[model samples]
Target: MTHLTLSDYDISAERGFLCRYDAPDVELHGKMAAVRNVAMALPKTLVTGRLRDLMLRDLPNNVEADDIADLTDEQARMAMVHYSFLIQAYVWGEADAPALLPRALAVPMHALAERLGQQPLLPYSGYVLDNWGLFDADRPIDLDNIFMIQPFLGGQDEAWFVLVHVAIEARAGKVLAAIPTILNAIATGDTDTVRVELEGMATHWAAINALFDRMPERCDPHTYFTRVRPYIHGWKDNPALPGGLIYEGVEAFGGKPQAFRGQTGSQSSIVPTMDALMQVGHADDPLKAYLDQLHIYRPPGHRKFIDDVRTQSSLRHFVEGAGDRDLTLAYNAIIQAVADFRSRHLQYAASYIQKQGKTSAGNDPDVGTGGTPFMKYLKKHRDETKARLIDA
Candidate 1:
C-alpha cells in the first residue's frame, strides 16, 4: 500500500470553500474593511457591547432583498465573509444570553449567499473550509496556513489549535459523503453493500484517529495546554466580560438577560453527524442532548441539515440485523472510535480548563461530557447482534 500524504488529498473541489475577502486584491479596503475598522476601534472591554447595540438598533427596518442585488459577484462574496465575522463577534459572541439577530444583518446575508451560490453563512464554515488545506497530509502542518479574522493572542501554537479542527472537519467530509451510499444499501436490504460501506466509513474514521495521533508532532502538549488553550476559553470566567457581554433588551428563556460564551473551537460540528451515523436519539439520550444544546451556538440551518441526514433509518437496521460478525465489529469499532475521539477532546478541555484557573461548572469535565452513553448504546447493540449471529 502506498503511503498517504496531504498532497495526495484532492482539494480542487474545495476551493469554493475559501472566503473571497482573503484574496490578495481585496486587502483591507472594502465595506467589510470598514466593519473591521469599527470593531478594532472599540475598547477591548466593550467590543461585544458596541457591536450588539449597533446590530440591534442601527440596522434599517426596510432594507430590501435587492440591497445586495447589484453587488458584483466578488463584492457579494466579500460581503458574506464580512457579515460572518460581524455576526460572530456581536450576536453570537454575546455569551450572556441568546440574542435575536437583527434583520439588518440577516436579510442582507441571505441575499449575499443567494448571489454567491453558497449556503447561508454558518459560523465556522468559513473558518474550516477556507483553512482546510493547511493540513494537507503531505506537508508539515504550520501556523502559516491558518486564516484569522479576529485578533488572537496565543501565537503560533494557537494557530495549530485551530488547524487541528480543520483537519478533523476535512476527515468528517469523507464520512459525511459516504452516508448516502451506506443508507441506500440498508434501504434496499443489500447486506453486502452495507458491509462494504461500513468498512469504508470505518476507514474515514481511522484517518481521523491518525490526525489525532499527529497532534503531538504538530504542537507539544505543554504548548497546547498553556498557549493554545487560552484562545478556546469562553466568557464564563473571563474578567473582561464579567456579566458575559450582555445582549441588550433581549428576553430569552423566560425573560432572562442573555450572555453567551466566548469563542469555542469547532468540535460541536461533528456531534450531529456522529449522532446520525451511530443511530443515537436526541430526545432522552444524555450524549445526544448535550450535543443538541451545543447546536444552538451553531448557525440556524446546521442542526436542520443534521436532522435531515438522521431521517435515513438504514444504519440502525443493519446493526440490528446482526447477520455478520465482521460487519458488526466494524460498526462497533466506528462507534467506539467516535467515543474515544470525544474523550480525547474532554482530556484536552480538562487540562485547559484547569490551567486557566476556571471551573467546568455547567459543562461536564468528564470524558464525553454526556456520560459516554453512546459507547454503552453501541456495546449493547453489538453484543446482542453478535449473539444472534452466532446462534444462527
Candidate 2:
C-alpha cells in the first residue's frame, strides 16, 4: 500500500524493496526536477505584510532598537525558502511514491508539508533547488549533483528500517523546517501559514519519533561517526558545504553556532533529534529511564550532545592532520562537553515543564545542534504547534 521499497532505507535492498527517486522504472528524475521547481515557487506566493515591510525596510536601517529585527529579515527569507522546498518535496514524493516499485516514504511527508507550509531540512535534494540561490547574487547553485546513498538495515525484518527512513526524510522535509516559521510567524501574524506549517512539521516529527528501527547491520559506527556525522554537519570545514548551513561561521552573527544533520527536519531543536538517536537503540523503560537519568560530569541534560560535538570537532581536526595527542584530547573534551550539556539540560527541562505542563512531549527534536536554549524557545511557543493542528 505504501510506496516504500526495501531500497528506500537499505543500501542493499536485501528484500528487494526500495523505491528509486530517479530510476528507469519511473520518471523519478523528471519528477525530482518538477518537485524542485514547485518548492522553489512557494515563497513568491507570500505577499508582503506590514511585518515584512518592517523586516525589510525598518530593520536594516535602524541598527539600535530590536537589533534582532535586522537579523530576522534574512531568517524569514531563508525560512520562506525552506517552507517552499518542503512543500515541493511533498508533491514530488506523492507522485513518485505509488509509481515506483515501492513507495517513497517521503511522499506522505511532502504532502504533510504541502498542507502545513513547511519545507525539507535534509535538503539533500534541496541542493537541486538552490536554497543558497536565495542569497546568491552572482551564479546559480547546482543541487542535482548530490545523490543519496541511503543506507539502512534491510532483509526479512527491514520493514521497520524502511519505515524509519521515511520518518527521517519526512522529519527533514516536514517537521524540522517549520520551527522557525512557527516561532517567527507569531511576530508577523502569519500564524495561518505557520499553523499549517506546524501541523505538517508535526506529521514529520511524529513519524521520526515513531521509527523504532536500527541502522543497517554490519555497518560501521565509525562510518556513522566519521563519515555520516560530519555530513550532517555538512563537513563544516569542507568548502563544498555552504557556510550559511554552518552555524559557527562569520556568516552567522545573530544566531548561535550549530551544525545541522541531514535535510531531515533538524531545523527545530536538533537536540531532540539527538535525544531520539540516543534513545533509538532502546525503548520504553530503558529509553525513558535513560532520558530521565542525568550524568554527574556532563551538563545537566546535554551530556550526550556535548560529547558528540567535541568528538566531532576533534575528528574534523584529525582530518586536517592533527596528532593522536589531539585525538586523545578530543575524546576527553567530549566527556567534559557531555558533563556541561547535562548541567544545562537540567535547567532546560525544569523550565520547559513549568511552561508546557509536565507531560508535554517536548516533541520538536533538535539534531546535533545545541538543545536547551532552543528547547526553551519551543516550550514557550509549543501552543502554536497545536493551534496549527486545528481544522480550518
Identify the candidate with maximal lDDT.
1
lDDT of each: 0.48, 0.28
What candidate 2 gets wrong by more than 4 Å, as runs, is: 1-122, 126-163, 167-209, 212-227, 235-264, 267-373, 378-383, 387-392
Candidate 1 Cα lDDT to native: 0.48
Sliding window of 10 residues with minimal summed lDDT for model 2 = 94-103
Displacement of the residue 353 alpha carbon in candidate 1, Å: 2.8
- What's model 1's TM-score? 0.60
Candidate 1 lDDT, 1-392, residue by residue in tens: 12222122312112212332233244434444564454343234233444567554533444445656766555554456555555444533443423344555555655655555443333354434343343233453333454444432324555565666666655566565565666666767777777777688778788777776655555655665443333333344334334543322222223332343333443245645666756754334544454444565543344544555567554755776757777777677677667666566555554544333323222222222222323443334334333332222
lDDT score, residue 54, model 2?
23
Query: Could you tell me every candidate's TM-score relative to the true structure?
Result: 0.60, 0.22
What clash count does candidate 2 reach? 52
Q: Where does candidate 1 stray beyond 4 Å?
A: 1-29, 37-122, 126-151, 218-244, 247-257, 281-290, 355-392
Compute the lDDT for candidate 2: 0.28
lDDT (Cα, 0-100) at 75 in candidate 2: 33
Measured by TM-score, the strongest candidate is: 1
